[model samples]
Target: MARMTDPTNALRLFQHAFECGQIPVERGRIDPTLMFACDEPKGRTRFNYMRAEGRTLSALVMFVHSDMIEGHPCFNIGYAVAETFRGKGLAKSTLVAGLNEFTNGLNGACIPVIHIEAVIAPENFVSQQVATVIFDSTPVTITDRESGLPALHYMRRINLPMRRL
Candidate 1:
């Protein structure tokens, strides 16, 4: 798993992925620079998993701390799989691995629970299916705060068990 910590490199990779149709455009424009923004509570964490070490990017999972639900941290989860890697369960597996690392970090920080939110385009059935399968929650139609477009919001609260780090 590759973690994009540099803004310039991250933006470049994301742009290349977009141009090659590896990333979906219907989710609305994304600002990868926000990954480095520290103004928001908990900020943002992104994990870019490559097919090979320092090689081709296969999928990316990003979680942005967007809100607090019932006094617990809430993050918006987003993911994309490379065009050639789609329909192969890559996205689901990548998300699982990425979320594991993310939650491990949270657990180390003493954050035991969090609310995970998924804001997906209404017509993006694949993402909706992934979210439903992973979260096992029904979505509610809501206007996306970032894109100002109608989206299906799926929320699930997760409890993090402590693990030896």
Candidate 2:
């Protein structure tokens, strides 16, 4: 089941990013189904995914929070694909799909529009390119809250309140 297996991938991502926290392996597992809910029951929820074809690749997920950045919504994306999946347009397509879903470009009952604001680490060039080209985002220097480190903040605005059809 997703509950039993997702943590393995989550742990891989968490450890690989060096996010500076000790992953508690003994802790109760989180249910992956909760991610697709219309709304999160708790704060800081993110949608997670793996490629449908036997999941040889994982889609690093992005989350948009209603509460952030001076009381307005903002997106903080963090994702990683297996090394083998890199340079194959996977990340670009993933980002495009995500942006379209959030920006009323896709059909749905209610599309919640939230601007994506990615903070790329200084050395992460590929992601920077994705932000710049796909989202047409421009970056500015800022300090990352997680590590108090210098980073690039890429912002792409979107329609607000989403569109209800």
Best by lDDT: 1
**lDDT per residue (tens digit) for residues 41-129 in model 2:** 25666544333223233444455463455444666655555566678876666565555443432234353445567777778787677
lDDT per model vs. reference: 0.62, 0.51
RMSD of 2: 9.7
Count of residue pairs whose backbone atoms collide, per candidate = 0, 1
Reference-based TM-score of each model: 0.68, 0.62
RMSD after CA superposition, every candidate: 10.1, 9.7
Clashes of 1: 0
